[model samples]
Target: MHAHFYAIVNQHAGNYRGYKIWQQIQEYMIQKDVRLSVLLSAYPGAPEDLAYDLASSLPDKESDVVVLAFGGDGTLHEVLNGLIEAKRHFPLPLAYIPAGSGNDFARGAGLKSASHWKQGLLDLLQTTHAQVINIGSYQLQENQPRRFFMNSFGIGFDGSVLKRANQSSYKNLLNHVGLGAISYLIAAVFTIFQTKGFPAKIHGLDLTKSYAKAYLMIVTNHPYFGGGIKVAPDAKLHESNLKFVLFQRHHLGQIIFDMLAIIFGGFQYHMKAVDNTLLTHDFTIEVNSGQTAQVDGKSIDQENYRVHFSKSSYPFWLPETINKKR
Candidate 1:
């Protein structure tokens, strides 16, 4: 059987490096004798729309098609939405080549540098390792239907950071110089200083736990976000559940101290006002009327939204692997 490669390039991603990286991928696939197709996103929202259309059209041929993403987490998020909309199920696999700022998803997958990323992609094609993993889904209370995400989603102060990050002029600078983490750090500090605590009702693995209002609530399928912050330290891709972590309300000094500890991987047990909780499955967050939430870095203004861990609901394709056991 032959393998087909579908490369999606977001020209605006990471200072317009998508096209250049796509060219390199195109050439590499040819060298490997892999069939190739290219999708160039012309503007914002184009990639998601295009991916959905392609998934709907279904390539005429039967050879496996691997969608190689060539941008940051946001680009992958868009592709995931399109694939989900196309009805891709869990068996469907996705590959990444980090070309954008804050390449957190790729970093978590053990593909840190360009050299390592290339090796990982080749391994996916040549090795005997492929596993179906669950992805997270979200839906607002009053908006359209439900949507899906492959990374982290949240509500509250951190959600506000994501919203502002999207609108930041620093994004261009971040993409150009690969300083996405620094940009997020500056924005987060600014956000924490100005944002006030808000009340939220959370229900998941445990509901009786009590505390003051939360700074934010995050549900994740992976361990990293905001570039490299381990938001949900125990999240795994193959798991059928989501990891829930809450930064409960506390004094500014305490919050700052806890955050510093978290940066060093030493804050998990320093529970004072609130615990760094973890959940394995579904969860809900109830906020005052007129609150907002963010899923995969995209913000939605809604009173509340319910997000959960679920198997992929579409027909997705994974790279073929060689077996050594046989």
Candidate 2:
């Protein structure tokens, strides 16, 4: 039986690689006799709009329906949130093609670049295997709309770094040449000097704590962050809990050293300066006003927020071949 494949391509991702990859995937799908429909995301929230429309229009046939996101983690993040918001009773397996800077989701899932992505995706569609992963949801204030994330969320230092990188002119060019991770490092150097710790309170899982100078807090659903840095080595996608890595105020020299250590896989040596906490089910973090936050690489304006995490309602399709090797 032929399958229905919906491809949401982010044209601006990966320095113009999205269009080329989409064309290649289209040719391959046509040759395999699969029914394919393509949608190009023209702006920031376009994927969410496309995903909502596609989910609402799903046919009642017995054939399979797959949604493929072609972009970075942020693109997939938007698509996943849209799917959840659609509130469809039927299952829709989601696929991703990495075409953005800092494709951490792809990296953690053992997926490679588009060198052989066509064949890999074809294999994924042919297999019946799908992985049910956890999703992170957050609301900045009371009665506000909630947002979901699949990778990780950051407040303070990391958020500031992402904000800087987004404003930098070299990010796209660096991504084009396979040096996207360097962009984060460059931004970190500048952000670290300017970033200051803010007052915050954490209440969750039978524990309560307050910090006067919380430099950064990273809540992770997966192990990788900041372009392949293993911030939480024990994190797994199937886990129901979230891993929190809090970096407190430290000397500039120590902060720089730890940053380099994370990049070089020496984070274990700097454990004394960082606090690692595991949160089950839900938590609330109250931060001082005017602090920035980020979810899945997109900046958010968060002052006080509550985080609730649980397994996704549906399964995410991953390349079985890649999963086996990992």
Candidate 3:
């Protein structure tokens, strides 16, 4: 069990659960005699800066520290950016408590909290089995080489949806109305109506292919996105590869049916018109003209980008054995 814990919290996360979850985690850790440090992100880029500082200053002995992220995938994404900026070859392990809307990474990582958070903490503490999960890295064709992503990145329709979702004042209200899936639903509907799709050429794996027009192109290192939607059912974190799912131009009915299939977790194979495949290492995506790209949830102003896969053998400890043994 890790004796020391540090948490970087996004206070404005889904329904304001970030602080509440952090307090609960703190109480639980105290009960187990674990030392903890809590840092609340007051504004947008705070957590990333703090996390980078911490990662850069990690002790020489690789101090027993674990970072608990108390927000959605965006928070996790920021923490990852900070860690990468810190340039730690072997960064501290990450522990996630899904407190934000669209906790996609948490669902994909299988670390969603149960009815009680103490159980989650105990599970992390008691587990022994470990795995080294692969994280995808991407660089925009228009931007410098400083930016990369650890989660799913997208272009075209999905990126546009992300833009709207981030700007919607009704996002929180919708999340409260449902299990954080409402915002995505609303966004998807809007995107379907507004987008005619875009053109892109994608080369990956044995699937080096081109698209005359695509509704969206999503590159996932893990299975789920937009909360629990399994965008690519076959993507595995431990697998040394990436998965690409492209929705070609479709009619409104096809779009609606494909969205339904995605919600049901078999859209890739179920939708005959969908292009879904895996890439071993490198891939390039070029759009016809102007296109928006998004890494994690941040939108990038770019028309093209090249993704090169590399391995970061970070040690990840999980409760897989205990949870799966049942």
Listed per candidate, the RMSD to the true structure in angstroms reads 3.9, 2.3, 2.8
Number of clashes in every candidate structure?
Answer: 7, 0, 0
How many clashing residue pairs are found in candidate 2?
A: 0
Off by over 4 Å in 2: 59-63, 302-313, 322-326
lDDT tens digits by residue: candidate 2, 1-326: 34577888898887786567768877988887878888999898999999988887876433477888888889999999887777776757788878778888887677766656766676666756566767678766666677788888888888888888887888878977767777887898898788776777788668788888788888888788777777777777767777888877767887777677677774643477787888775787777657778889988875555544433435777765754323
What is the lDDT for 233 in model 1?
69
How much lDDT does candidate 2 score? 0.77
lDDT of 1 by residue, 157-235 (tens): 6677777776789877775665666666777777777656677666765553433567767777777777677766667
| Ordered list by TM-score, greatest first | 2, 3, 1
Which sections of candidate 3 miss by over 4 Å? 114-116, 128-130, 176-178, 204-207, 303-313, 322-326
TM-score of each: 0.85, 0.92, 0.89
TM-score winner among the candidates?
Answer: 2
Tens digit per residue, CA lDDT, model 3, 5-58: 688888877667456666777787788787788888988888788889888788
TM-score of 2: 0.92
Whole-model alpha-carbon lDDT for candidate 3: 0.71
How high is the CA lDDT of each candidate model? 0.64, 0.77, 0.71
Look at candidate 1 and give me any clashing residue pairs. Answer: 87-314, 87-315, 88-314, 88-315, 89-314, 89-315, 92-316
